[model samples]
Target chain A: MRSGYYKETIVEHINLTDSTLQRAWIGIGLLLVIAAPFHFEFYGLSLITLMMITAIGAMGLNVLTGWTGLISLGQTAFMVLGAYAYAISTESWGWPPLLGFVLAGIVPAIASVIVGVPSLRLTGLYLAITTLASAFIVNHLVLEFDGLTNGSSGIFVNRPVIFGYAFDTDAKFYYLTAGFGILTILACLNLRRSRIGRALIAIRDNDNAARVMGIDLRAYKLYAFVASSFIVGISGALYGIFLSFVTVDGFPFLLAIEALAILIVGGMGSIAGAILGAVFLVGLPEVTSFVFSWMGSSAQSLLSTSAHEIKGLLYGLIIILFLRLQPHGLMGLWQDARRTWTLWPLKY
Target chain B: MNYLAELLASGLAVGAVYGLIAMSFAIIYKSTGLLNFAQGEMGMIIAYVAWSISTSVDGNPFIVALGSIGFAVLFALAVERIVIRPMMSEPILSQIMVTIGLSVIFRSAIILIWDGLPHNMAIASGNQLVDLGGVRVRAAQIAVLVALFAAIAGMWAFFRYSRFGVAMRAVASDDATAQLMGVSSGKVQMAAWAAAAVLSGVAGVLFAIAYELSPSLYALGLKAFPATILGGLDAVIGSAVGGLIIGVTENLVGGYISSGLKEVAGFVIIILILMVRPYGLFGEKRIERL
Candidate 1:
């Protein structure tokens, strides 16, 4: 009898209540955005902005790995390209910084096509290795073309200015990133609703079946790589703006892995997952360190030295646990809870 | 001419070390169909163990080496049971991610314990160099190459003769068929992981003698990946040959072209090779039935 009631509630929720629930969730998000930043001061605000930027990066990865089923470890390389493009255009070529941001996305998209064309034929882990190799090659190339990239010392990025208003302060940059972050989420949602997105999903589920359905495998695969990389590149430009500098050392294999982790933890195929993952991963460490500091001076000192090591350990454990038990990640867990809540008053 | 000879000698030695790790990778991949991304960190951990054992035992290199390999086998078996056994039925991507996670954990654990300091093995080789027709080479380098060849030859003989080895081969060829014939897939996979870890352990100890021990040594695991790919992930003998090919090309490029290209050359070559042969040179062709 409980199972029957549970089934009825699930059926009713899916058939009748999805739109209402979605609107309620959207309202919560709007309220949080308006009220949340005012609660935190400068450092916390900056961290949240950083989370937003990384969320953009994670969402870009989701479009490829989660939605389209292409595993790439080269997101950092694309971001590096975006950063360098922004720096070179704005600082070296004397272009407006705003225009440089646009070029940041465009340039890496072109490079993604070059890298993706040959490697996409190989399946599974083989493609992953190819992308990883491309990242190393690109890293070397960045170092080699020192004349354009200013070599290993890195390039200083000018503060983003919009019609005489400079986003130089943390608060100003917070709004700047928040605006872009919302735009990225909206753009991602729009993309998932588009024909191309459906085709990408079709290709991911079954390539042969998708081909039978007249979806061009090569075109869509390349499109996924290029499109996702473009968003990642834009985030990269924003990353440079946040740091006020771009360097080769800033992007490494670890950064790529971190982005991949964020995608997995956020619930790969959803925009909300990306943002939630960004918050969890980025915020958890900060909270941990704060707790450690409250213990004493010695613990604080130890934390300073081994903070990153601890973070790596945590990230590894989380990946293992989530993959083993909750492969759908935090977003999936949220979905399960929502289902259960909707079925309240029935024990099942 | 002498410069060329010395470069070849050095390159061959490094290649030999890479060959050891590649073979290690091929071992696990053959039976389990999963790439152990943590292969290098496993090696580094074992090397640290070997170093510790050497210091405690008054620097007896042979005993330390043997002890390290023993520890590695045990560690690998434990890891297979705890981490990988649960993931046996998971997607290939999730399995790979688990390995990546394992690598991260191992690396960080090493840093936490060892404090990221570089330690010299100070092994018995003692920087000894020999002159062959006026081209100098380290005695340790010669030992490395000889040991690599001997290990490969021993592996070939074992696979052809040993009962457990043949069972592993059977399982690799067809898991269900082998199971029907009374072979345990779990045991075979455990043995494969143990063997792979042992090989990596030996490679790590040898590597520490040539270079200082540091946490960053795990990067070699990534470097050896190309060798595994170039030869075929499941081809044991191909790994040795692939390792040598990558090793020689890297040296030649670094010697003749800018040294900067050496690191990038392996990847570039692998990409080109993969483009032409999607399954690698010696990889078994996978036929998908849709």
Candidate 2:
């Protein structure tokens, strides 16, 4: 029993060290940011932008799944809501682009309330199926609501204009998206430290125990839904505006799964995991495709022919490989590296 | 009146297919605690492969369908061996994600080959029709009903009479106890997957005939999900029965009420059924750990 208490103290000490590691990571991130612009080509800049968008979405889903333990298969639904909200509000309604971006998040937040109210009763796979239905509903609505969504022809989004500045180039969006990425990471960190986050973690680890602790499971679960949907919405708006179009063709249920995979591979329950996840899961494919493009005709043609088909297969393989061999994901791998480096002379 | 019967008949045909899809879901859940999200996609892949083989060499439709069924059995074994085996003790969410990833791979591969075009093709059966009372039922729909009936019988026999089937029942009730009895629970889980794949393959081909073979057919994943929820996730028979009910009610609602609200009706019933009986109509109430 004394040993158990000692173990708990060590665990707490390790958690404190993990926070310090995060600060070190931030230092590394700033250094990378400083070096990146000077060294980046078009593909490099685009890769960073893609990673930022992916990190934002994965972080949003991390709250829902990693923290709240609501296994959703439909974060893409919120994303679709955000994208369309951005497209229609900015391009169609003549609303200010900035406000449209904000609305992108607001719309999904409202929609999550509607969906989550019915859905909060469901646990585990039932909850997943509920969200799956929502994803289908959203997909069908987007396609059929052509009168508003422009049907399957797609919605064209205008470039982001804040005050008078327009972010049209990859480099420009990279900076903006990266800024948003930093803010989002900060928000997620703050949320993690907040009371609501603690309640959520309690519910995730044990719903009944949390309920016994005077934590309202329903309220916290809905909070997860809202928070997840809001972040997914913002990411969607960023994606749509950055691309200057919104299409149902791209935002399928797969996006939700892919985001989850990224979250898992990066670390199911960490901010640094979110970063490593977005970079590895989302950035890996882009880098792979870019490499293919550079290999000239044969490789380019092969990638063009099969790239879409291979992405999911590769992501699945990565997640499964990591889970079986390294369940702690990238963070676990990082820990192993640190331990080895710190113990270099002993060779332990 | 004829039109109404025809629609009812088609609804029954389609609903049976949905029932089969739901049954595939139910069977896997009964044996292993997994909600295999790839079940529908598995069906789609088998259907496409069968269609490809049949149309490619102009092979006898019978031979092609049989080949496809055989392939699906092997496919299930391979999937279980690779994806499901390693993650036996993995979290429920991760197990489900493996299926989700497989679903995407299946959908995209179908597209890469089929190029997203809808295919309207006859199955092993021709365009024969029979008049039942005043209703004209298509031959393919009849085939679907027959396939579903045969599937139900096959499952019943395997579960009730056969030793392996009985062992599967034991495993389904509790894998550890079954393992204690020396009935290799892993083998039972693999067999259950094989059975699900066969059901999915048959349902896929028939449903492909009922609705044209479109790449968008993967979207039908959720069409069976509501049925599974209504029937009870672990109740195999419940899947079939719930599917028929959902099918008839949906078509009737679409016929009587606004068609736009058809999905809403299906979902509402699902909610009601789930709330009223989470174990579903035929499912045994499971004891949850506190």
Largest DockQ belongs to which candidate? 1
Task: List where candidate 1 sits over 4 angstroms from the true fold.
Answer: A1-21, A35-37, A345-348, B287-290
lDDT of 2 by residue, A1-348 (tens): 121223356446434345676789879977887567678998777777888898999999999998988888888989999999989998889998889978998999999998888777778777777787777677767876889999888888877878889877777778888888887887887798778988999998888999999998888888999998999999999988766779987686668878888878988888789878888887777777888788898988867777866686677677667777777789989988977777766556
lDDT of 1 at A60: 88
TM per prediction: 0.95, 0.89
Q: Please write out the lDDT profile of model 1 over residues A1-348, one tens digit for every residue.
A: 234334356345434235677789878987887666779898888888899899989988888988898888789999999999998998889888778888999999999999889877866678788888999999999999999998899998878777779888887788888788888888877777677988989987888999999998899999999989899998999998888899988886778888878878888788889888888888878988998889999989978999889888888888888888889999899988977887886545
Which one is best on lDDT?
Answer: 1
* Weakest ten-residue segment in model 1 chain B by summed lDDT: B281-290
Candidate 1, B46: how far from true, in Å? 0.9
lDDT of 2 at A267: 80
For candidate 1, please provide the TM-score of chain A on its own.
0.91
| DockQ, each predicted model | 0.61, 0.40
Per-residue lDDT for B123-149 in model 2, tens only?
545446778898977777888888888
